[model samples]
Target chain A: MSLKMRLGLVFSGALFLVAVAAWIYQLKEGLILTNMQNSYSWGLYISGLAFFVGNAAGGLVLTSSIYLFGVKKLKPLAKLGALTAFANVTAAMLIVLPDIGKPIRLYNMLLHPNWMSPLVWDVIVLNLYAAAAAIYLYILMLPELTGRLGWLAIRVDDPHAFSERWAKRIAPVALLFAIGIHVVTAWIFSTQGARDWWFSPVMAPDFVSVAIAVGTTVVLLAAALAYGTGEKYQEAYRALGLIIFMATCVHLFLMANDLVIHSWYGNAETHRIMDIAWGDFGPAHLFEVAAPLLGAWLLMRPQILGSLPRLLASSALLIAGVFVHRFLIMPAAYNNIPMTMTPFGLPESHWSLPIASGRFLPGMGTFLDQYAYFPSLVEVAILIGIMAYAVFLVLLAIARLPILARENQ
Target chain B: MKMGMVIDLEKCIGCRSCMVACKQHNAQPPQTWWNRVFTPGSHRHLTPPALGVEFFLPVHCQHCENAPCEKVCPVGATYHAEDGAVLIDYERCIGCRYCMSACPYGVRQFNWEDPEKAHARSEYQEKYHYGYPEDHRHEGRLVYSPLRPKGIVEKCTFCAQYRDKGELPACVRGCPGKARFVGDLDDPDSDVSRLIKSRNAFTLLPEKGTKPTVFYLPPKAKEV
Candidate 1:
């Protein structure tokens, strides 16, 4: 047992414990566990699900490398990307479970679905994407699985012939499945209709670009952690860092174009939300504009923040920024039921519906307000559990399989 | 047996009586309702006293001849029956909320939790579909009718459950102004059928061609 592996196990185990405890408490309490209600039908859980699903685009990003760009040197990380996509998607599904009124009956969506609803389309597309991504990941893993099993025998001078032959056949076919997952997921968000921001013509490219940015961030962070255990995976880390930089550039370009159009022709309702980019949500504003700018800035001088700790901090910033982008983008396109007045010109009544009805004020106790959806302690715990669960699985696979064997080296 | 509706827009005061009546009769929770009043295209920017609100469309499911909700339901939970009334089999509903999202008019409502929270005991017992089966009327909780469950999709059934029992729909019966007309669209002499024939009527989003059976009277000019 390597020291790096031992430490990974401990950290993951602690997170897993906290997450399980929180999730159990929430399950017992229903959706009241989160700061959610009828008006805000979707809040933290849905947003988190969207981001996690977006992260599955990492496999598509990797396919672009070995298949599109012909970067054969980056081949080893392809499976890592697939693993990350699968883990994130699985985690996303778990988050959705407790978010609904009755998690068990989520399938009734298929039974009673209105064909026109974009929310229904999201479910269909997400399920298809998940299936495709899983198949893609498994196809890539087949050879590796066979290789590890053979190694277990080879070290003792015994080997199986059929497993090696089967492994050789499946590798090429997995590539197609990889591209399908991200493209389909992109279509789900982009094609929702007239959501100006999400329904933009540049959605497909934007989806791929952001996924690559987040995906590489995940890989780079993984490699950085590997370094503390003296695994010396700096070359791999740098390779992922470069991908992150390029993807960040592509993502920023799409955002710039989208923002320009919005600035020019955005409706009154849209301007109210987009103003947050420059308004009092300073940390969020900084995360969206400045953090990425600083990320791009750091790339120019990698020696400054390229070390393990700083790299982690920057990766955290990138994650936070992308998340904020999802938060704003999802709620950004909503239509607020405007306040009405009496015929006599007096204010008639305040309105209540799903989107804008929540009463929120900005302060330390902001979470109690209607619009203030700070993930409850249970929500945070569940999220932490999911992250830890993914990490635990990855570490266990590495420990058990010959994932980073000297044969590859 | 194609039962349907024709609403006289001129008489619709937007008092929301029909909506309130639907909620009360159906015993729907305060927030969950099958019918809604949308006053779209407010002529707020129009010159004063020029019919400031363009129209009030009291909308529910059209019980379309070519229903989009029926086609998209993966489990075959919602379907157009032999009588042409769209029906939902609640026993299989997963409540994915697809129908609610898909209906352009947004008529579908989720039973987000148990229906009891929204229904008083007397109301839930009296008005719930299937009426707690033949034997379970006194039980504290009734297994939801085959037409509704926590996870399954639900929408306006044209009050098919009541129509089957020779009762006027809760909404249609409870309407105070008699502004709403419901009858067999197949029978030319049915009051709603006659109403549609005399009025310049249209369904919302007719361009989508769902061919909704419900019709609305285009308000005609009246002497001041």
Candidate 2:
């Protein structure tokens, strides 16, 4: 194996070990280790799940868009997108397993499902999307694998012809599933009418547009980094960057629309959520909003967008922006429980009482009093492990599998 | 028949007896209260001068007819019983805490640690017990299960197990001010039903459309 691959394996392996340690600790101590409390029950784990699922959906959407548009130049990068999608979706599913309190009873979700629950819908659609993405990836690689590998060549007479026909048939269905997965995730939040922040009808569309932007940017950066900004791939990178810029603009527009509607005409509950987002969470919120706009500007500049280093930096910033966006949505809504009087009533005094009297514990507090949420050490470790695992899978695929399409083909 | 409660805010002195009774009976872990008393209004303190007409509001699960928490449970761990009481099946809970988030009243509490461990370390052990399978027994069954495991969401059941034995909920019976009343809401002649009719009772967060069974009679207007 190459030195880069060896180093990646070591790093991811360490992360995997750390994650296991964290999980064991969590199981022994229960969720008390985490900062989450009765007030903010769905914290970093749920937010991270949403972000990772978006990443996965974004990858599939980008690949499907390539086929739909008949972009011949981008065809070489399709395999990379498909592989990323499969790896990311798998990682997303794994990340959520640890968050479940009773993982042994998790099968009950499928066994005795509640059809009305958006969570069940999320499970059904995510599993279906993962399956479709895997098949799509396999179809993409079948011809190359059969032709190159000695064993496969002997068994298959015309793998190339069969793959082409099958891929053509499955592409549209895979695309549908990709869109469905994100919509289901968005619905999980939006369906909660009790939360004014998530009840907006624009949530699903916003999720889709942001996914496209982040997904396309990640693919662009990965391709540019792996295969230099040479003449062959430069056009493909530029096209992908343009798509990212467009999608980012749409995402920003949706955000602005939601903000204006909520802040201007919305009820007191909605305004309170806006206050938290623009007040205590101001720094993260500002970065989330500004980074994407700046990245779009960079992408618009021909010289900057063409340079591999600059494009990678811009994409990295854009991805961070999207992550912050996902993180802010849930907490802002949670901090806005209408009946909780702390945030609006007496600010400093009541906040200190719960903490001083030891009634609140370390992380526990009225939702109205505090909005600060620091992910516990266990949560951070688990998240790092999950990301590292995703990186490990992608690296292994790139090294062992026929991921890159041939130049002549 | 639908069972419900009517809390007289006018009579409540914020003594926290109901909270104590609930903890003792349910064997809840430290810092977990199925019932909580809040001094509503803009008053910084609970003093008589600071409080004008507003009184202490003790909040618990409303057990709504259109319960948001029941609708959002992915595993059907939380459900509405035939008797109109919102119930949780702990064995089926995946501990996703979706019901906690869905609850507008913030009545739901998740066991962050083992209830037994919490009880053992608690300073108030003399007042409340917290092992699995409570000391009290009914028909040879433990009044409260001892195995109150961590990582599951819990809330006030309105003492359904006690109600089954033709006894009042611990909170209602323990109230010194007789501020809390429980009866069959479906029965027109029930004391709770009569109280709601005569006293202009109100439910919390009517805009939420939860249709809460827990009614509240606002404190009587203070004389000048």
Query: Model 2, range B10-41, lDDT digits (tens) per residue?
Result: 89888889988887777666777778776654
* Cα displacement (Å) at residue A129, model 2: 0.8
TM-score of each: 0.75, 0.91
Q: Whose TM-score is greatest here?
A: 2
lDDT of 2: 0.76
Show where candidate 2 strays beyond 4 Å.
A147-157, A340-368, A406-409, B42-45, B48-51, B120-144
lDDT of 1 by residue, B1-224 (tens): 88688898778767677766665555454346567664534332222333333445577777888765665454556667666767666655554333432344445555544455334422455455532133111112221253234434455666655665677776777667778888789899999888887886767656556788889887655344
Instruction: List model 1 lDDT by residue over A341-402, tens digit each.
Output: 12212133232222111112224221111243456777777777777877887687667754
* Residue pairs of candidate 2 with colliding backbone atoms: B132-B146, B132-B147, B133-B145, B133-B146
- After superposing all C-alphas onto the true structure, candidate 1 shows an RMSD in angstroms of 6.8
Interface RMSD of each: 7.7, 5.2
Candidate 1: true interface contacts recovered: 0.10
